[model samples]
Target: MEKEFNKKLNHLTKVNLARYSTMRLKSWGYLYELESFHEARAVIQELKKQKRPYRLIGGGSNQLLSSWEEGVYLKLPKADLHLLSVDEKKMTLSCDASTTVNAVLQLAKKYSLGGFEVLTGIPATMGGVAFMNAGTSLGEFSSLVSFIEWIDGEGNICSKEFLTSDDRAKNFSYRKNHFCGEGEVITKMILKATSRDDALEEKITKYLNYRKETQPLSSKTCGCVFKNPAKEMPAGKLIDGANLKGVHVGDLFVSTLHANFMENRGEATYEDFVALVQVVKEEVFRKFHVELELEVKI
Candidate 1:
């Protein structure tokens, strides 16, 4: 069975990774665009059995791809974006991991679901958002997740419920979740929907407008670079207080519009990003006496 699956899985070599990650760093490596959960499971088992390093990425909106030569990268392609089911009575929606946040919002709107409006402007797949507990001041994805179906390291399909009484629910916290481990790929998720809101469209527009005004939405960035240190002190505010906005290392510059975002002006390398991050961290700590932690994955 393993041999048969291996025959079907293929990987591309020395693929340009700029298009895969929002950071747009000039990096190249092997890429496995798995078309199905079966393919993903097979790939994981093969990679593990061969002792080869691998990384899984979703929409790449929150990842900084540096040296890709160290490991092969796996991703669920657009073809995997499937709206599996929706139960209006139960206020639940189930979707494939690769389904974009926008797609989910559109479906939610069709059914008059409300809570998803908070995720408006986040350019990520459902799997990525759930894995990172992605959200804004409005709310986090953890609050909406009912359960997640994933491909574990051993090529087994596993599901974990996130009910309040479930101990696994504790794995979720600020901008992070531990349910999905290293090399485990989230395949699908069941999200708890909220009551009907006729104003869902207006709410989405409002959130979108707010993000447009405060974030560098058009810039080549990996979203927010650091997580908010506290409710009172946002990372952007801290960076601004440290006077680190507009700071640059090569073409990677701290966005003036949003201090938490680092923009790739042109031809920025991974080294430039690292240097800029170090500079910002040191200065922010010096001025605020608080250590800033990164929100984006490297």
Candidate 2:
């Protein structure tokens, strides 16, 4: 049965998960890189028949490979689905889920579509980006999305269209989008377009510059380690205020440039990262009376 399942997927066995994850924490698992939504749905169906547990991941930018044992890890390949389409009349761009957010933004820019310029430096696929509702202070992916197509828990492809502004904002919050189940998978999305702008180039430049200045962009780390407790009390500020910067457990240390980010200074283990996170959380709670929630998925 395992052999038969293997035949249906682009499979790799006992892969070092650290290579796939942004934080580079070593873990091993079977990886299934699905080529299309049909392949993904078929894989999900087979997993159900076998009663095998599975997880869907993208880019691995915001994920932590802590305990991925006895489970199948699913991923859409980094290659674009070549499903891009433009609707000049409606001012919209439709793309497949496997497309990177960077690619989507680049396409938007090429076509002169505005609005996604604020997401310039983010590193994630369209599906992961939409699922997390990723954004900075400028705005969120949810604000630009028109509708989504995904595989639902029942192994059926479902389309959810945002009919109103409130409907669009329904389940999204700071660093969160709650539209899909754990077993569900987002396959495609349509983004509401803004008119072409020559000034968008400058806007994207400003956003990229801001991220470069504040984030440890060149280091090996998951984007942001913790969610902001409140607008006035950002997680980094709190961790910095607690004097936790440059604190280390093994080779994993709190990034001095941004306390909310933990950098892996080579030879770091998942246990090391976890330990450091615990220390920071405990210390932040002890001193500030505020609990920090992780932005990165574990």
Candidate 3:
């Protein structure tokens, strides 16, 4: 069974990653595009046996890749992104981890389910969102997640249930989560909607409009570059106040529309992104006396 599974794995060497990432950095790396959860489990086991390193890539919205990567990268096929189930009576929705946030939002709207407006304008998959507890000023994804399923490093499936009061404290926090550690991959999730709103469309439109007005949504960016230090002091405000807006290093620049976002003008390199981040961090820290934490993964 292991041999067959290993043979089924689809891999590529020196794969161009410009299309995989939102930033579109000119980068290359090895990749494994697994077709199903079983394939993912098998790949994990094989990697363990070979003592090789691998990381999962989802949507590539919040990641910044270098010019070249050494280890293997794994991705679930887009075919796995399906709406598993929806129980209106329970106000619950289940979906594959590969499902995009936009797709999930559409599903919720179709069912007239609410409580996902907080995720408006986020370009990410369910797995990536759950892994990072992605959110906006409204609330975090942890608030809606009732159950999570993932594959562990040892090639075993694992899961956890979250109650209304325990999800935030037990598993999630500001732009971070305790689950989905190194080598683990989130497979599916069951999210509980807070209400059934017939006006869900209007709500989502408002949210999207707000984001469009405040963010450089049309530009190529990996969402927010840094996490907000506190509710009162947002990273964008700090960076803007420090006069980092429109600052550039190579082809990357701090967005004037939203200081928290760094935009790729054209053909930006990984080194340029890193240099820009360091400059912003140093400037923000020197002025605010607070060290900003990266929301974008490297």
Candidate 4:
């Protein structure tokens, strides 16, 4: 049975998880690089049969890692999936899960499909974006999502369509989307698009420039560390007001450019990152009476 499982699983032993995550922490885990939905279902079956726990990750952009104990780490592969389709009349693009948000942005640019331009600089897969409902102040991936298709725990593919005007869709509020089911692995998404216009391109350029000017985009960081407490109360401002910038626990330092970002100066450990988070959270809460919640996932 182990031999048969090995035959079906495309995997690596004792993986250096730093290579998988953008944060570059030295995390170790068993990794399965899934090739197809059939392989994914097979892996789930084998893990269930063996009673081994497992988790799925994509892009690894929003993840912080320390170690994994006795479980399978599944990737939908970093490879780009098919673009599926582009409907000019309806102004939509259907993308597969493995595709990156950057890839989607490029497609939007290619076809002059506007609204998605705000998502340009985010480094995440379509699956991760859908999972986290990732976005910036301009807009969120969830807002654009027309439908999400995923593979459930029992290996059944399911689709959930969302209407923008629906009250349930409104539940996908700031930095959160509740569309995903427990043990459900996202497979594809339909994103709303708009007609090409130079004005939209101009807006995209403006947002990109703003990010470069404000964020530590070139540094080794996991983007934002804390979610905004309110629409008017940004985490960065709170951290900065608390005078927490440049605080370091080992090599992990609060970015001087952006307080919400923690940079890995050199040889930072997971413990150091966690400690840094604790310090920031405590300081922000103590100074402002606001308890900051982590935006980055572990």
Candidate 5:
């Protein structure tokens, strides 16, 4: 069975798949560089045929495949923007999800699009943002999405859900719509954006400056370490208030730059990240009459 599995796996990486995907999750993993969507589909088909395990990865910016699970990782063939279709009349654009959010923002700016100015600090693939409904303290990611193109189970491509007003009474509670499901995938996104003007440029500048001053942009950290529990408070504030900044477990430590970010300072391990999160949760619960939740995948 194992031999059969390996026979079907394509361009497998060197690290023990188990260790790379889970125990030693890092900025690096079974590094396979693909070049197109068809190649990915072929691999997925083979895995289904061989009954082998695999997990799709994009950006590798938000994930925590635990040691307890075993699988392979698949990625979009490349990180290029497959398409960027703008509609000045609607103030929206259809974007490729494989590209980074920053790239999308730059594209938006080139076209004088305004809705994405608030996302300057987020550094992730557009697909990832949709998968997690990623957002800031002020708002959620889904609010800007007018529609999306996704691949459903069985690999059948589908388009934006057309719902009536009553059918759309509830916004996606999680704020994620485009990317979802273990076996399904998302190929692109369509965002409801605004046309830019002088005022929009000023707001963009403010967000860009905030990112420079408050985030560890120069380091190897992924992003925020934990999600804020609600509207009134933030996770970093809670952790810092508990005096947990700079706390360490192995090579990973809560970043001194921002208490909510746990960073891998060269030798950090999965164990270090997970253990430190436990510390933050405990300390915060003790200090405040509240509990904190993780923003990081692990």
Candidate 6:
């Protein structure tokens, strides 16, 4: 830590009144944002000392924050981007938890790299996306990742590779990665991608344009409120059929644009969002005999 930062730490706290998400009115979380990998490790130790539970945070684009949290909210600080190496046929990018996924994608696009382009419009950092397996049909982040690295609870760095089928099985669902537990923090991620120029740009433009038209790119809410069921029914369509296209509770309302999106209209409470989610589920189940499962982290 720098001399100035050490001075700031004297006043820095684990508990904070910070807005936790980018969309739908703001909800509150006790923000414990870290700015460096060392700072992240230090913050985890602090939380362990206090014996308080905490959740990791990214861009806050795809999650809901409660107005009142039951535990500490750990956010990776905002200056962890470090470009490790970019090769001829493949590229390797390693980033701290604080680096947003968009930043990495932007860097790769400028260099004419292709694999990360599918994630062009998705928000959050590479660490967060890797943890949650964030992706779109064009591709999920897991498909592009070759190895993952993180800081253990003991404060030691470790790396894991799941490129082969056998190794990949350990991850229940790429979307359901359970490695971090409650207090562990991701340090960086290394991924390999095909090197292509014209095709990569074209793919990126198509996905980005489609995302803008299909999703409320301008609205606030965690992206895609629920996961698609294995039975082939989309949660959004179910919610819409149940007549929840304009549903609202407090300032939280389902996006008029997409049923799966819950817009935070600038002053909604976390309670409102949760309540609306319940309503959508119950109504859908009552009428269709199908239960809607939430994918949003609340």
Pick the lDDT winner.
Answer: 3
- Name the candidate, 1 or 3, with the larger lDDT value: 3
lDDT of 2 at 52: 83
Show model 1 residue runs off by greater than 4 Å. 1-12, 79-84, 165-169
Candidate 3 clash pair list? none
Using lDDT as the measure, name the better of candidate 1 and candidate 5. Answer: 1
> What TM-score does each of the candidates earn?
0.94, 0.94, 0.94, 0.92, 0.83, 0.88
Clashes of 4: 0
Model 4 worst lDDT run, 10 consecutive residues = 164-173
Best by TM-score: 3
Candidate 2 lDDT over residue span 1-298, tens digit each: 4456557553445678887888898778887877667777878988887788888888889987765667788876555557877787787989988788778777777777778775788888888888888988878888788889999877888888886779867868777777787769898989986566777767887888888999999899999999999998999999999999999998899999999999998978888978898999999999999999989988
Q: Give the TM-score of candidate 3.
A: 0.94
Tens digits of per-residue lDDT for model 6 on 165-190?
55555663735776665457677767
Root-mean-square deviation per candidate: 2.0, 2.2, 1.8, 2.3, 4.2, 2.9
- Tens digits of lDDT, candidate 3, 1-298: 6666566443445778888889998888877777787788888888777777777888989887664555777876573554566898899999999888998888888888888887888989998999989998778898799999998878778999998666558889887889778668888989999888898888899989999999999999999999889899999999999999999999999999999999999989888998999999999989989899998899
Show model 6 residue runs off by greater than 4 Å: 1-18, 172-174, 195-197
* Whole-model lDDT values for every prediction: 0.84, 0.83, 0.85, 0.79, 0.65, 0.70
* Model 4 misplaced regions, further than 4 Å: 1-12, 167-171, 194-196
Query: Could you give candidate 1's per-residue lDDT for residues 29-96 as a string of tens digits?
Result: 87777767777887787888778799888899998777666577887756354466679898898898
Displacement of the residue 266 alpha carbon in candidate 1, Å? 0.9
The sequence of per-residue lDDT tens digits that candidate 4 reaches over residues 200-285 is 66677788899999999988889998999898999999999999989899999999999999999888989899888999989988
3 against 6, candidate with superior lDDT: 3
> Which residue pairs collide in model 1, if any?
none
lDDT value for model 5: 0.65
Shift in Å, residue 263, candidate 3: 0.5
- Rank all candidate structures by their lDDT, best first, as comma-separated numbers: 3, 1, 2, 4, 6, 5
User: How does candidate 4 score on lDDT?
Assistant: 0.79
